[model samples]
Target: MHPDGFAADLARKPDVLGRLADTLRAGNPWAPVVPPGIGRVVLIGMGSSAYAGGVAAARMRAQGLVATSELASSPLLPAWGPDTLVVATSATGGSVETLDALRRLPAGLTTVALTNTADSAVTESCGAVVELAAERENGGVACRSYQHTLALLIALELHLAGQDITSLVASIEMAAEASAHLLDTETTWRPQAADLLLGPSGMHLAAPAHRFCSAQQGALMVREGPRRSAVGCETGDWSHVDVYLTKTTDYRLLVFAGSPWEAQMEEWTTLRGSTVVGVGGTVPGAQFEVRYPGDDADDVRLLAEVLVPELIAARAWQEQF
Candidate 1:
């Protein structure tokens, strides 16, 4: 992986997130593209875009909107008519699967593309467009675009629900601040990376939404920088498959501090002599802790939390170079 390109992508997060906060404050950025009379919402995309859709689907479901997520590659679309809304996200607006999914939808169905580029393939296919105002990532990892897409999806959901996002904007600004601070102190993570990089790394989060977004990004960034195997799963699910691998292999775990299952996983892995590194708050008996400055580990906090793994990846690149 190119070290300078990796760092450049990580550096763009603060500005990108800050811009999103500003856009939220200026009223709904996605208002023009908000689908009319959406009964069921299906979000589809690939990679980080798919994970971002999963995050949005969770929040939309919580708001009593019938929402679900599917990978654009294999969208097991249920039978639904024109009222069904399909929102596809592709950072570059050029993902073939996403465009294909959009095309395969019922002709009368309302489809929107949440993408970084307008007039791209996805935009040409969808009925409406919500463009993300983000710079192109120099690195292959979709760092800033993932964060920007998350903010836009959250904004879109709030607009569709006809709810004010004042509190959400505040949380976002706080998250941006946390991201800036993390970038400043990114070097502090090097030793931790050195200690943890001796083996394969896995990331597990407590909640499904956070797990989907953070863990997927973690694995992607890890592969981009360290060129190592990084697996992502929910906390409880880890015990079923990943735990067995950890016990027998030289595996390290990156447990996002949230859930009771996290503590159990830490203990289980520690007992097996696997190094566990905590991402957010302290995990009991973690080999190292990367404390992020937020009480709530909501989707907004993810803007800040993603920085840690990128730093680890950067360290790996540095070590190799």
Candidate 2:
């Protein structure tokens, strides 16, 4: 890998988020309370930022808000109204599709933007901005921006739900440390990812983040890194549909779990003879576990779990380009 690679930038996640913690101490950006009578919230972004929108949508739904996430490129953008809250998130705030979606919102509709870059397009298109208190993404993979965006979205959700976030806010440092620990201990995970003999790989996520979108970044990493074919599917959906077509021994599987189907998927994959690594949650009989090293309520899992796939890409693809 090059000295100035994505891996180098990823190593600095702890500092990026620690600064975010300090920024939060001063004040939260999503303040003064979410207005009453909000009908629904639509979170729009492209790629990884769109996935962050998914996490925020799930958090908002748990808080009893009617929320949904859509791609900025979706032709069927949700109908906008006075009561709708439209949020556009882009790491650079410069994605043409996301900026265009924000521009098309009703003039009086409430719109918010979460971004790392200031004076980018979305800032002008939206009514409010919660600029991430983090640096621009390096290595072209957006490792820091992706993690910081998720943190910012979770903070917004906590404030909107009127919950005390003192404890949640304090866990940021712990999360970074825990992430570092995971990376340090799992030293072989990255090298194994470059194995020439490894077969096609698959990724499944059990979360509000849809499978394809959740795995989108990881798939890109593997493609750009090891230059291999990788596929993604929702956890249960994969268990039911794709499981039948594959010989268990034909593929290696990685499951990012935060749902109840963990054990079932583990047993199924084990029966099929595929190796599995569980992150964020465990799967019985799996070969390895990249445990989410914090309490269940800790939002750091969202930030930390992606490091596994990222490291793989960095090791395999870093010097190729």
Candidate 3:
């Protein structure tokens, strides 16, 4: 096998991350987040398209903005308020739901569109645009594009919110270092292991909506990796009922989180005989833990974890190429 063939499985996230990390050099990290004194920020999208928006919203909220993330098709739209900043994130830039919401935005609302396709409908409807080149064939269920979108939004939030962009960028450097180590060392020989992941039974992944939006899509890549059914659920919620359904027969794959609860969860997963691969800074007890560095290292590791699964999925589908 080619040395980098293993990289196919790891490619999804780092490709996007390289793009995301580059935004540290962006001239306007502190550029206006909104027209002066905005009351709220509405981030809109659907599906993984919405996931990218959620990443942005998380950073906005972390930076202390009254930000809200909603489906592009939310029954409510905020327009009466002057401080409303609408951020539309779409990987394809042609998501039907986002296009519809873009049209619904009232005149004078500031719109920022993040997309891989500059010519798509979402771009046409927005006031400002961040053009990205989505670089996957048939896009692999929206890969690097969404990651870059999240990266851009994260950087933008850190910059504009006056929340210490310098430190954040420093952390991105750390994350990149950690990602390189994982790709070159830990992930180097995991493709064959991926075959073990293939089975009639489903694959179980855990993360809350906070991590799910991005992690779920990346897990789908793993589904492709092993050509099996993969189900993602929130951790504590999964603990309530779903984990009880786990049996020796179920092909469970645990993606460990860095939450304080992660150590306990990781222990539980091992006892159940689930295949565990740990990524991020705090996923203790994982069979394979890749420590990603960042100011919010845990979260950065969470997002970066998606790439490993994507590479695994690419392995399963390699014959098609």
lDDT of 2 at 181: 71
Better of 1 and 2 by lDDT: 1
Residue-by-residue lDDT tens digits, candidate 1, 1-321: 367787887877777777777877988866776656878888889998987788788888888888888999885876578788788899889998888887778778888888887789998998888878777777666777888888777887788788878877877888887787777876686576556744644433333334457777777777767677777777767777677776567777776667567766766776888777777777766788777567355654566677777777776776787
Give the clash count for each candidate: 0, 1, 5
Runs off by more than 4 Å, candidate 1? 197-210, 295-297
Over 1-321, each residue of candidate 3 has an lDDT whose tens digit, in order, gives: 231343442444454455555665564432753456656788888876676676567767867877877898886976656667788888777888888988877787778887777677887888778655445435336665655566666666765575556655555556556566556654554554354444557666666556765456766655544456777666656666566655646545556464455655656666787666554544544555444444255556544666556666665667545
Clashes of 3: 5
Candidate achieving the largest TM-score: 1
Q: TM-score: which is higher, 1 or 2?
A: 1
Model 2 collision count: 1
- Where does candidate 2 clash, by residue pair? 248-272
Instruction: List pairs with backbone clashes in candidate 3.
Output: 9-311, 9-312, 10-311, 38-83, 225-313
- For each candidate in turn, the TM-score is 0.92, 0.87, 0.80
Residue-level lDDT of model 2, residues 255-318, one tens digit each, is 6666556666667667777666666666665576666467254366656667777776676564
Top lDDT hit: 1
lDDT of every model, 2 decimals: 0.75, 0.69, 0.62
